[model samples]
Target: MINNTIVQELIHEIVKEEEGVPVVECLMEGSITDEEIAEKTHLKLNTVRKILYKLYDAGIASYKRSKDPETQWYTYTWKFESEKIEEIIKKRNQEIIENLREMLAFEENNMFFACKNGHYRYTFDEAAENNFRCPECQEELEYMDNSEIIQQLKRELSLYENNGSEIAFNFKSYS
Candidate 1:
């Protein structure tokens, strides 16, 4: 199963193309020059450059460039920033938790009514004002039970809260 981090998914997709490639293995070791990465991975120089650029754009990779005095050529040393991936995972989980809070509040606050035809839903005030009739079907509007949905949201929020901290701790240790 895929984890929640976007970084993980992107890395997975890239590594899936070729197993035991140097682009990934060498970077995973530590900081490595692009040329070294290409040589070690047996991948074309252009392919290694493309991979580094892609990771750099995603903030999961970083590089430092230096000019060679003798050759007058620029050298770029790249490193995989595992910390950045952990940060992204935290951000994604936080956003998910915040959205869950907003949805739970909305679901728990309003009293909704739905028609027997299962069409549209309205708040209690709207249903009362509309004579408890469905706007489209004109049938009686009954109370909508949202407890199940609210419970589900609660469960999701709890999962994020509980898992986020543990994941952060393990990520730090691994880094």
Candidate 2:
């Protein structure tokens, strides 16, 4: 898709600004050698290679290796995979949504009580067995208001879901 905005954001999330600079520039170019990337990004060659390797390990980048015929120096040319980035972000967002949903379900289905003194939460059965008192401070337990927390989780979940849909995979070959 020849996109730089989304690729820059994704690289920034994966690496430091300095590291992300080269990665974003080179990645948008489809593919480039580490040396060229370093020169273009104004970074040290070793730094560029290290950052590229890290991205590759994360499956955000891929590379092809070749050897110079004369010097026999092995060189790797890398390309940032936009398709993989979208998949990673979407997967992570879905995982977060799942966790939030589980928490919301728990909060809605369970009756929770809290100690007025220490703010410790306990299930209804625990509170009742303890005579509606705080086990630690011996203070009276009150009904815990988790509505705000539930609402917040719901909002976050919705945001993630919405953001997940923002990226449309073009699946076009950069090469």
Candidate 3:
């Protein structure tokens, strides 16, 4: 039933696959002790604890601490917050969409010039201030056509807007 790829990738983001995925899987089973997680995942106790703490810090995992009365040692029981995980992903996607919108607006508003040597890019004001020459390479700056870039941003923005947060992530490491 753990079919959420976003949760999987979020865990992969919290720590390396060697540690993160297994720890997250164990936590998803229900509240579990670090020792139990290590035993189930076949990872070192310390490694499991580390991954758990990282997930905790990321707001997708939480732990309950209790004192073992006879042993006088603290025990921690950890659980994965599936709801919080989805919230984090949606917030991240919204941030990405906002950034893309800002980029599209800037692209639509600006006239850009770039050096032939590809050393610099400047807006109209900067290019005019420098006499349309590359300050770094002393090459004449040429008008840069950004139509393709604008089109690409538009396409990407449209995808996010239409699909909401359920679109596939381009997380190269996880995917």
Top candidate by TM-score: 3
Over the stretch 27-72, how does candidate 3's per-residue lDDT look in tens digits?
8788999999989988888888888888889888899999999999
Q: Which runs in model 2 stand beyond 4 Å of their true positions? A: 1-9, 16-18, 126-131, 169-175
Ranking by TM-score: 3, 2, 1
Q: What is the TM-score of each candidate against the true structure?
A: 0.72, 0.80, 0.90
Show pairs that collide, candidate 1: none
Is 1 or 2 the stronger prediction by TM-score?
Answer: 2
Q: What shift in Å separates residue 135 of candidate 3 from its native position after superposition?
A: 0.5
Q: Sort by lDDT, best first: what order?
A: 3, 1, 2
lDDT tens digits, residue span 101-143, model 1 = 9999999999999989989989899999999999898999999
Candidate 1 vs candidate 2: the lDDT winner is 1
List residue ranges in candidate 3 displaced over 4 A: 1-3, 165-175
Candidate number achieving the greatest lDDT relative to the actual structure: 3
lDDT of 3 at 108: 96
Greater TM-score among 2 and 3 belongs to: 3
